[model samples]
Target: MGKKTTHKFKAEVSQLLDILVHSLYTNKEIFLRELISNASDALEKARFKGQAEGAEDTVAPEIRIACDADAGTLTITDTGVGMTRDELMRNIGTIAHSGTAELTRLAGEGKESLDALIGRFGVGFYSVYMVADEVEVTTRSIEPDAKPVVWTSDGRTDYKLQELDEDLPRGTKIVVRLKEDLASQFTNAAHLKHIVNKHSNFINFPIYVGDERVNTIQALWREPKFQITSEQYAEFYKFLTFDPDDPFDTLHTSVDAPVQFNALMFIPKHGDDPFGMGRENRGLDLYVRRVLIEKQNKDLLPEYLGFVKGVVDTEDLPLNISRETLQDNILMRKISSTLVKQVLDHLAKMAKDDADRYADFWRAHGELFKAGYMDFLNKDKFAGLVRFHSSGLEDEKGLTSFADYITRAKEDQKEIYYAYGPSREALNLSPHLEVFRRKGVEVLYLFEPIDEFVMDALSEFDGWSLVSAEHADPAKLDKFESLEAEDKPEPLSDTEKPVLDKLLARMKDALGDAVTEVKASARLSRSPVCLANPDGNVTSSMDKIMRVMSKDSSIPKKILEVNPDHPLVRNMLTILERDENDPFIEQAANQLYESALLLEGYLTDPHALVGRVQDLLTKSSGWYVASEK
Candidate 1:
């Protein structure tokens, strides 16, 4: 054995060490993940190089993890092109590897396009000491002529390397001497198995904990697209999502461009399960060239897509000071932005490729798309992926693209208009949509409840505004010539008009001034009346859901738009005229307003309307006895 020679870290490593030892990583056990990941990377590299030489022996396949608690040690070994003396000093001791130096040297070299050649380094190696009091590396190059070397570090300020002759093997072995307190973690085989399974289970290589293979997962990201069968993706989705249901949509892509990355992402068929359990999803995982970076990296996807499961492999992320503290990391941010763009772009293509399939995806995960549309922060991209049902399409409930909406728009139409209802049938009957249907104008039918806020978030798509069908002022039709005007519905007689007008004034008094200039409604066709928010602060759909769930929230003052045309309105007018002294007229007015609300998808007590209906029935029958009560 040679004398233990120690050398200090390069400035960056020294700065990085302070960060790692202090608070860069939230958990110390991630050291195992980092070291094991490096072993896997090296093993994969050896496998690639071995393929060049036609070496297919399983003996030197890739990676193996062995734990020795008696010595308080955990060893990760890889039969790779192990480091030579100069390579060890350059790679391990000084951080002067050609890859790092070349990156710095060529930094200003045209957009810093060194991504094709550069991968991560240094940090993943030093991370071992977070768990181990001491870390030792025994390595031998597969070169037939090169000798073996060992490197040792306590992760303080220095490390040492020397020539070594062990039970002669051509590979690299990392042995970690666990701190006395942490010894029990590796002492119990089950605990060690847990860490490996959680962090490194999908490592492309076979990882053995004692005699059993612990990492049985396939690194599906790197496999060729054609080679990955749907069965494989489905099986992988089960493991990835931990759900029994099949995927809602799966996107697997390999790109070699601005950077090299392999990614597999799946939109789960069921988010309600985990969400119902009150689980906060961690979003899609992050990886680097097939090595696990973090199993639940939130930054890899938006919060709305937190239920999705998959892996993103980028070879160029800096691994932070500790591989664990990757939030808001510079390279990670860039990668995340790029990933969002890619996912949105792919989804847009999917929608364009097959309308039926994409509509099915919309049916399965439309809320997520709406959420992304609202808050994804990638507006331009998300705008393309959104799908909706439009009355403009040929079939009932047939879907239309935003682009299709644009194309079908009137020559002078400067905005896209949509109406919200609980059902397409309901929308078709909505009093608010009367003029739109008469004018042959198309409206996107927003059946979803949250789409009101979602549209507010989206605001506009491709320079066209999103206008709500409910709140669009009929007076605003002054902007365009009335398409056609039929005779106004027969007005109540002058004698009856005063009573309705007087009653409407009283009803408006009961509702607030937010009701804005209420008169007999021109919009109603067959409906008695409908409630509308004139200011558009809340949609009727939103009001219904909130009132059902929240005790403190009062239903907003809704404008009662009554049909002077409908038979119910006519009867109310006649009753008001016949009995100016009758309290039943006022009760009918209140019930009519409330029933209008019910029609608008807002909740209402039917007993109140039913009681009023019976009141009128009893008054007409002249059965004002105890039987009426």
Candidate 2:
């Protein structure tokens, strides 16, 4: 038989219903998930009780949602341990809480927002008002005196309850009458599927929307590290990043510190996360218990580490919420800091135990390591982990640690000479390395892009300045070249002096606004000329990137230093001797300037350089020569 009836809610119950309806502002839609959460909690409790009594759990352990879009109703039924009449009255009606009256008063005065207060007092079930105009709960108890009970509420001022005789075995069924305006959310199959995936992808049981269980993820982060194999971890990493490439490293840690947490973090084999773009980044995920929380949590780690891909689980999280904005919360901040350090420690361990593997990682992510060296917060730790290919030492397999670099510092090497370019071969071939090699100093070969930034940030390492190889001055040259060598083998001749003066004057005019001065060489030994920044603010590469990025046309000024002893400079000196009024002088000067610019790693416009070379050929090949004889 069936009957319909109504009864007035208790005074507390009416106020509770009011708060539940309007309290949750932004998180209103969570009412469905909250109800599902409570249902799961009930089922878990029931399962625990059954386990305690040593009885087999025969009920299929899953939560299912059936939608009737045409009927304008959605029923969320669970085969969980159902509630009896008194359980409903006490759990649902009275609003189980200790500070219920105070919260109700605080909420009614509108002084406090309802979102925070909703699930705090078992009002998770009331979230239905966020979407539904009315809800009816039909449940049957497992108790001997159990009977089917119906509790109905419009989610406003009051609710009603009644008993009925039916064959609803032993579970809870909640039928929601969608608000007329929002009925489409329940009716459309896709929307229901989206909601299930977004919020409850890893519920303890199969979460069926319509007919099929939408959640298939095993929530593998919760598994014990010993139980998980390398293949399993790699599989999960690929699934997390969608990268067929296996991870280079994995770190799984469970901490119950200032805040409790279980984190499984990995650094992918490739040093970048491909977000469909060619650009690289860190890919780290955050979860709570077995449910995925935030798929991409950037704040937990720094950007240079964008290559990290993994999951973190914490019990402290309400798990019933949005983790996008988790970093601001105190709990998340602790987890973020702790997890980053844990991964770093793992990397350090790799360096100590597996040099070959760590070298592979270094070869790929050396830029990121250098970036960490630049960031003030991560510097000390990242610096210790930096590995580089050294020039003085043999390049076999292992990377040269900065500690080893310190041990190899020269007797009079005032600072650590470092050459940062595209490669060890390139830096070694550079004109900039002449003085360092002449001085018999071991310059650290830095090929990574972030190396310059790290050296600039570090400034000094192990009490020695990080001197760029290109920087002017072979300062402490006593070890190789003595102070007596500053004396020229021969003085600047009176005849050559006038040529130098004229050459400098014409250069100042031709390269106006592009060079501070065209000085005679002092630092140059083998090269004809070299360029240096007068101000020496940022690195040349960074300056060029800035000029191009900003599309600025203003040419940066540079100081030009000629090697007085070089064969090219001597040839130019000889040419100037014949031509005080030489028409080819301008072409000769341009060629020398362009050559210096190329050596300095600055961009020299190719068209003008080609024209200058063509003019040189025209003059040398008798094309512009008057009477070749």
Candidate 3:
């Protein structure tokens, strides 16, 4: 051995080493990932240089990992371009000095494949200290006349470097003496293989642990779309998500503008948490040059798109020293913007090409996808993808998109109407739908409580306001001729108008503050009464959801609109005229108010409603028996 020299680590490097050994990474196994990534980078550099120099190399590039359980030591060796004495001093002696980054800078545009290099921060090698008491690096450069060098360090204040007289192969080898507490965990070959498979399985180079080859999986996302087969995609999806069923659809995309990244995303056949019991773990596995940097990185996609799964590998992202967290959020947002666009574009194509398959996707993910209404930046795309069951459809299972609804809308229609109910059958019975049914207009049916929030967030689409059927303007609806041909029931005669007015006053008095207003409803044709939000500050569905969340059971006050032409309303007017203090008129009025509340899902007590129905039934039955006798 040549004369040895002792050198102190950079002041900042010493501080960084302390952090790396203690708390820089949440998982101790991350040390293995970082070291493997560095090795991959070096191999890539060597391959790029060989291509540039037109050199015919004979050796195959690979990484080898060996464990000595009894000795409590693990060794990793790579057949890649190694470092010289001066190069080692510059790369390892200083902090945050990346050889890969320097080579890229020096090569500039001459080396196109240098983008595959992974290590951007020089601190990755020091992470070995996280699991090792001491590290030894023995390397021989490919440069002619370059002697082998040995670097020894305890990862503390100082390290020793010496030149070796003997010739060695052109590559790098690192041996780690495991710390006492962590020795058993890392010294076994099986455990080391598991670590290699978890983090570096997709690395371009082959990896070996003893006689067995690990990292057998390919980075299929980096391959061209035309070269990949359907079977391969399905197999890869299963491996990535562990979902037994095939994916509903796959979105394999490569973007170049704004940022460059390759992504393989899948829309699962069914959501992992369809009921949303708790916050689901979401986001894609983020990779940098095929090395796993962050798993389930929520920052890569918005919460609404959490149902999507797969991997995203980008060279544009800047990682902090630990590589566990992202250094720049702006680049992440750019990548996210591109991803959202790609996903929406794929769905749009499916919707246009295969209606049945698109419908299946809607059924599987619509509940969660509807939340994308808040993504206003992609509002047009989101609107094009939303599907709803409409009054025009024959059944609840039938679906239509907003674009289709607009196409079917009447020429004079300016607002897209929707209504909320517990079910389609219940909505058919809604008093609020009488006018919409009469006008031959379609109304979207909102079943889930979140549907109300989605519509409210959207408010409008394709220049048409999304107005609730219950909140439709009476005057605008009157412009459309009634499609119903049979209408013989005359409105209250001119002389009886005063009686109707008195009945309205009496009913208002009976309901008291339960109603904001009680007036004749011109929009009603079949039902006697219906409720409306006077201020329109909150939709009835949202009101109920808020009430449930806040634990408030009181019914919300709303306007009560009575149809004058209905038989029940006409009879109530006669009863009020005969006896202004009649108890039956007050009871009937209260019953109508409670019935309307039930339709709005706000009625807290059904006992009073049940008793009123029974009272009316008893009186009617008694009259029927007397007539029969």
| Per-candidate alpha-carbon RMSD to the true structure | 7.2, 5.2, 5.4
Any idea what lDDT model 2 has? 0.71
| Tens digits of per-residue lDDT for model 2, 41-131 | 7677778878898989788877878888788988888877889888987777666554656765766687554545552454667667778
Candidate achieving the largest TM-score? 3
Q: In terms of TM-score, how similar is model 3 to the real structure? A: 0.93
Q: Residue 422: error of model 2 in Å? A: 5.3
Candidate 3's C-alpha lDDT? Answer: 0.84
**lDDT: the better of candidates 2 and 3:** 3
Worst 10 residues of 3 by lDDT: 111-120
Q: Mind giving the per-residue lDDT tens digits that candidate 3 earns over 286-355?
A: 9888988777888777777888999999987653222323535677778988898888889999999997
Once fitted onto the true fold, the runs of candidate 3 whose alpha carbons sit more than 4 angstroms away are 22-26, 96-121, 319-327
Backbone N/Cα/C clashes per model: 0, 6, 0
- Clash total of candidate 2: 6
Which of 2 and 3 is the better model by TM-score?
3
As a whole number from 0 to 100, the lDDT of residue 245 in candidate 2 is 84
- Overlapping backbone residue pairs in candidate 3 total 0
Error of 2 at 476 (Å): 2.3
